[model samples]
Target: MAGIVACVLLSLVTMVHSQVQTAFLEYMQSRMGSVEERIAQWHDHSSRYSSELRDFKNQVLKMLENIEKEREAMRNEVESTNVRVDRLEREVDYLETQNPAPPCVEIDEKLTELQIKKKKNEKYEKLTDCSDTVSQVNAMKILKRFGSSAGLWTKDPIGNSERIYVFDGAANDTFFVFPRMKEFTLSTSTRKAARIKLPFPWIGTGHIVYGGYLYYVRQTEEFQVIKFNLANKTVDDSAVLPIEDQVPVYGLSKHNYIDIVADEEGLWVIYATRENEKNICLAKLDSKNLGIEQMWDTPCPIENAESAFVVCGTLYVVYNTKLPSRSRIQCIFDVSGTISSENVPVVYFPKRYGSHSSMKYNPKDRQIYAWDDGYQIIYKLSMKPKDELH
Candidate 1:
């Protein structure tokens, strides 16, 4: 009986120990699953933070590149400014050397006298009737016979008191120089002559002699004012007058002619356009570079203006007349906006209207020269007050 009871007690102890082992195993499995879940969440958060950091780094790189490019652009701009300033300084020094300071004089009195002269010149009025007597008028006889189809006669631009220049456009494009004297008679010789060849073949309309150079229009695609240097006998392409954009349909036809005149104020280019509502443009040329300095536009008084000339800063437009009673109509305009519609008497020329007729005023002689190209004769009219008789 004692042996049997000991065996029963051993069995009971073995069963209780197996139950305790099973409960311990179940608790350990639940704790391990919770820890594994927390670890997985941490790993996901780390990956997201890494991606955000990479995007921020890329943005910083782009910003740095932009800043670098801007710095380079600023450096280039500063360098260009410095170069321009240096060039300007050099130009200023050269101009100073060319024009020296004049001697001191009566400043106030000289200024007052200049003001008075300016006012007097500004108050220009149409003078009395121009003389109609051809015989009584002083004539400048053409000494040299040029084969010119078109010509302009004007006073010497070099300040020679007794000389005149004749720019013959079609006569082999020659420039004839004539000398004035006490007696006037026709001759067959010239004091000096020069041949001017333009880039184009067409002859220009109006011509002006200025500072040993002859300025005329080059009837090219764009009506360009060409400067022919007599000293070098070369055409200065750099000194072309800027008028292409200033005029409408610049080189449309021969009728759109450009008239050039030079006076105390410098060179002037005058033209009337039919396209721009028949407006007239007057441009003051830069004497040194032949650039347009100042421009003025006004309504044209006459249509199909044949010729334009300026005297004492006053502009005159001449129109052709076919009627026997009327020879030519002269329209005077003051560009300073002072005078308008001043009726100046027209001088009658009997059967002298030609296609290539031109008129010029000689300030030194105070005479008006009208060229009759058809007859190859130049008729002179005196502008002097004494010569005007009713």
Candidate 2:
């Protein structure tokens, strides 16, 4: 009976062990299948994520390329605009000349005197370019040319004596006056021509005049106020400036420009200084304290007022006005205002006109002479008596 009972226990234990082993195998299989399914799903998700990331990167690269192209295009446009502005400013220079231009000023009686040497003797003739097509009536004619050879030609305040002074062009650049003599023969052994030296290389532009042993500049890029003493023949390097209590455009730039004139009372220098785009200063040197006492600003940029002069204390500004169509009008400023259709008269030309030069006012003759490139041409003007000028 004891042996049978032991056998039953052993069998029961074995059966129990088998059942536990089978259950453990089924659990292991189920866990392995779930792991495989999860692994497949993770691989598919990773592939899809990688493809999407690549597409996003490509879109970002395209956007960056577009931004770079836009930046380059803007840079090119800005560069082009700057180039155009520079060109327009260059055309505003005063020295620029047109091919076939208009007249500078109106020519009238009293001012058309041309000192010509017809024969060996001096003869006064009406100054007119026979080539001129404009209508001109014969005013009184006079011959003032002396048999003396031509010398330096400059405009002066005094209208009498010689409307134009002539000196040898070969005169050295030392300020010396021509002795009031026509012919001189200092023996054939020692031949000295009648010549004077200017202080400096007579700067090639503007009206240059000689009087009171001083050389004057009607217009130039140099300082507006300069003097060449005939006694010493040296540039008054002292470089007297008309503006005392004023600032300059830069440390190097000066205020003097265009024209200058001198009389017994003092010297007058007309200069241009730009303040803004629209405002331009036309300062008049008073010469009292070596500074500008009176200054006037104009809206229009004066083309060239150096050819202008004061008559009876009234200032006349000569300038060229460019119309909308680019046609130019050479006009003069009067006492009325800077520009007025009634007061501002257009310079009269026949077939055409050309460049300009220095000008002078003859208070005695009541006329204005422009030292033009062609020759001296006269214009009639209505002005008050000189004595009335304060």
Candidate 3:
């Protein structure tokens, strides 16, 4: 009975071991198949990515080739333009060599014929901006040094009166009147000059005696043009200037508040009146009533400018350094359109005592009376048609 029981137990153990081995083999086979499927999917994805990369590379190569072609075309165009420019330059050089420039005398004659000047009396007329331009400052004669470094001295622009009036400073009540130019030039003392007193003290260096009347800026106003009789020493008329901003007329000057000048067209004034405070403002005044007849916003700026003078309705702003170097006419604004900055040549004043305090242009003598650092000066000018200027 014991042998039979042992045999049954062994058979049961063998059956259990066989079943476990078959289950392990089935699990291994399932796992291997799933892994193989995953590997196949990965391979397919890599192949698609590779194909897309190749397509992108080809597109990039095509774009680069097109860029190179455009670059070559641009290079060719630039080369063609350079060649044409070279040819034009050569042609210009050849033409210049063939026809040399004419003499200055002949050129002046031709320019005089071509240029149309504005008549002093003509109020309105169409004309070119090339009538007459200042070429050279021929002679600079320093008359004498009087009073302070800043003053004004000038003869009456109109009449044949050789009398010269001298204002000794930017602010003053009295001025000296000389009998004649010769007497003033020879005398070193102020005793010889007749002292004339103004009813009101004047301010700034923009004062001038014209037509027996002294035009100046009065001390009691922000900026007023005062017409005083030189003979009677009384105020004839007064007008407020239309200054947009409150500043000096010349930026470099300390007392050139507003400039009252006289040209061929009569009384005028120069000031800065723009909102931007840029260019100078010119106004024409009626000598009788001292009313504004016309106004022109000129293009001449007040920068580094010490003074200005008008000739035949043309405004010439004179520029100089505060340290006192050479003075030059940097801007020209003509109301009649007969003179422009481009039309005029670079006009430089000869070096003298110092910067000019006041410069007055006389149409009668065709000269400039200037006061430079207390020294009275006469600048002889060379005028010519614009075409004759270089």
Top lDDT hit: 3
In model 1, residue pairs whose N, Cα or C atoms come closer than 3 Å (at least 3 residues apart or on different chains), thus clashing, are 143-187
The TM-score leader among the candidates is: 3
Q: Global lDDT of each model?
A: 0.56, 0.42, 0.79
lDDT by residue (1-390, candidate 1, tens digit) is 998998998888998988989889888988889998889999999999999999999999999999999999999999999999999999999998999878887668778556533433233233422322222234544433354445666664446655556655532355556555312235444534433454444354466777777777665556666777766778764444433453421222243366777644557777654545465666666656776655555454445455655655556665554432334435555555544434355544444435434565554444555455523445455443323332
TM match of model 2 to true structure: 0.40
Query: Which residue pairs show backbone clashes in model 3?
Result: none
Candidate 2 off by > 4 Å: 1-152, 155-193, 207-211, 217-224, 231-237, 240-256, 262-266, 276-280, 286-290, 304-306, 319-353, 380-390
Better of 2 and 3 by TM-score: 3
Q: Which lDDT tens digits does candidate 3 get at residues 208-297?
A: 778999988885546777889887777878877544455677887868768888866677877764463766777777778876656676
TM-score of each: 0.51, 0.40, 0.64
